[model samples]
Target: MHQEPDFLHNLHQELRDGRRWLDRSIVLAYAAAAGLCVVAFTLMADAGFELFQRIYRWQGGWAVLLWLPAITVAAVWATRRWAPGAAGSGIPQVMVTLDPAVSEHQRSRFVSLWLSFSKMALASAGFAAGLSIGREGPSVQVAAGVMHSARRWLGPHSGISSHALLVAGGAAGIAAAFNAPLAGVVFAIEELSRKLESRSSGLIIAAIVLAGLMGVSAFGNLSYFGRIRVPSLTWNALLPGLCVALASGVLGGLFAKVMAASLTSPAERMNRWRARFPLRFAAGGALVIAVIGLVTGGATFGAGSEAVKHMLAGEADVPSFYVTLKFVATWLSAWVGVPGGIFAPSLSIGAGVGHNVATLTGSDSIAPALIAMGMAAFLAAVTQAPLTAFIIVMEMVDGHAMVLSLMASAMLASLISRMLARPLYETLAHHMASALPGPASTQDPPEPAHAPGVPQQK
Candidate 1:
């Protein structure tokens, strides 16, 4: 016994030591990747804002409308030519990487990463073109893709471990984008990855903290919406707040249903007109332009952040007509096959709706609170992720005090929306994937044997 020294035991001990070292290395890699994503997104967002401002100065109000058509055409062309998988929100594509329903050919980590990058670029371009979209979701996809690539290159043997890193990167992306580490971690757990293991939790935390620190160091610790102070809470206000929350939830549900229905029907129609995508997009762009020209005097075409600011600053009266116009414009722009996101536009709509309610109630002070609540509520309703929605609004507005109301609103909205329709991402993914050829007919290219991570369901 002494001579043999338990050979199997010695081997097991060595393997355990190796695994510990690998885990440490993976954590370090996650931290670095998270930092990089924070810097990239911050710089990109700042530069994108400046570019849009320049375009506005040069082309006048007409620039906003022109952006819709131009970006739609470009995004459509790029998707069809370079990476068809990147056509929509990169979330669906990421899901495919994990599920591999198509075939081995489509399951390459390289394809996932490349398609994600292309989509990120296109989405950024679309935003710079003055389309009403947000970079957060795209950023999440891009970060995950980058981490996937890194794992493939540096830790090829760590397939299962790499999934942890992918989640870490995604969390870091959200943290970097919003400068809210806790919210980012929660989002990764609740929305993107949909699962949390003990080991992965530590990795996610490290990534989020590092990414948030990087964002703060680079951008001077600025919140996405600056600071929003809530008024004193009162027992009397609770009832009104509840009523507002209920209404917002119902409306949010209805909005999500309408958008999903519109998107699915038109996308189906597009199958027949796939050959003329460019022209169709161009025509759609022209329509966007005309809508802006007529309704907003050319003001409501872009991300509507400026409009939100105006409403918040008490500089403008948010009329129903404007809300309706923005709603229609964003709906059409998204429906017409443009590579954009719904977050910003949804916030804009929420703000407008909140302002309208405030005017009706003759209370300016309550508007901001209502706006925050409505933003979360409506988003929760549409996305069907109450926790994510609540955290997103909290981070977006820097409203910690309103967390309770935000939670209430979000839950109500999610419940109502569920009753009205399916979750936004799920519906979109299902409709899009259903149209594609079956896995048997379309096999993915050969690739490394990456572990299929758990798929995130909405």
Candidate 2:
């Protein structure tokens, strides 16, 4: 071989190094955009809580009841008209869109700038309307949309999809939404991608950091839930922890089963109602929530955050049927084709379960631990990512001391959840994946809905 001079080798090395730096710069740009989007999303979600509060303060029960139908109808109409994939906890949409197997049009439909904006607007509307939903799940899809759209803006073929930007966006979204970067990292590994791409490690971390900063800047350093005093684990930790875990897990699993079933079987009543009358079906859900709210003194409305916090503070008791009501509310929100999430609703529900266990078992000695365990287990059951679940609960309440108890509870819950049904988000993702349109246009054609009587459109 002819001798290659050092100068030529040096020039080649320089070009390679320059490309790497350029790639990183591009990622930084993506992170900046994603972080800003999360900031906007946080504000939008806050607007929802504010709206609910304002309405509640102004007119109380009647106002919320009146707002529900209108918001649901508008949210559904706008989402279907402009962004069908925006419906439900946006996590499933992000999950399906992240799949390399998805087409360009489908990806845009599920995770795009338009979808991100639509998710924020509609989800916020749902919250303000007193729907039992959370903003965190929607934030995942919204962040994915922001990053993906930024990639498209970077260039027609900026290779955004070819890289791990979607993965990074999802992880960053969780970090921003929850203010828990470690949980976000764990969520990415255990839930979103379920595998790490060595090339994208730096990209993922940078995105998470930037987004988390945006959150901190906007909200200040607030805990999702204040620190709790978990009793020092005596040999007594096992029994109550187990009780909470098993109960939370089983209940969570059952909730998932009902939801999945409601959308799956054409012969099922939910299918019949949704197929022939989509709008009516959503109205029915709204009605159920409203009635529940009325019966529960409006406890069933919103994301149930206040109630959960109250319980954790030991300042107020969870209502007797709160777990059951919260489940129904969450289930109804999922059933309706609306932009919302069950994460907070699920946590509140888990809190209710734990409180009930402590009360029923009369285990006041370790009540707080049981409650912590319930939150971990229930979240695990819904998400089917025990480590992520427990980590999130641990972070929310600053309950690091209860890690072992939470871990055991979370794992047990997830295992039981696995046995009862498909993971909630994954099953929802399956539905969303099928609904993705082919790559014929930037906008997707009408989705292929699984609702029994609803006809698919081209």
Question: Model 2: which ten-residue window has the lowest total lDDT?
Answer: 449-458
TM-score for all models, in order of appearance: 0.82, 0.88
> What lDDT, from 0 to 1, does candidate 1 have?
0.65
Q: Can you write out model 1's per-residue Cα lDDT over 191-281, one digit (the tens) per residue? A: 6567766755765677677877877787777666766768886675675566666766677777778777766665565534644555575
* Residue pairs with clashing backbones, model 1: 104-444, 105-444, 105-445, 106-444
Worst 10 residues of 1 by lDDT: 445-454
Give me the overall lDDT of model 2: 0.77
User: Which stretches in model 2 have alpha-carbon errors above 4 Å?
Assistant: 1-16, 153-163, 436-458
Tell me the tens digit of each residue's lDDT in model 2 across 240-291. Answer: 7788889988998898888778765678876887878878787778877877
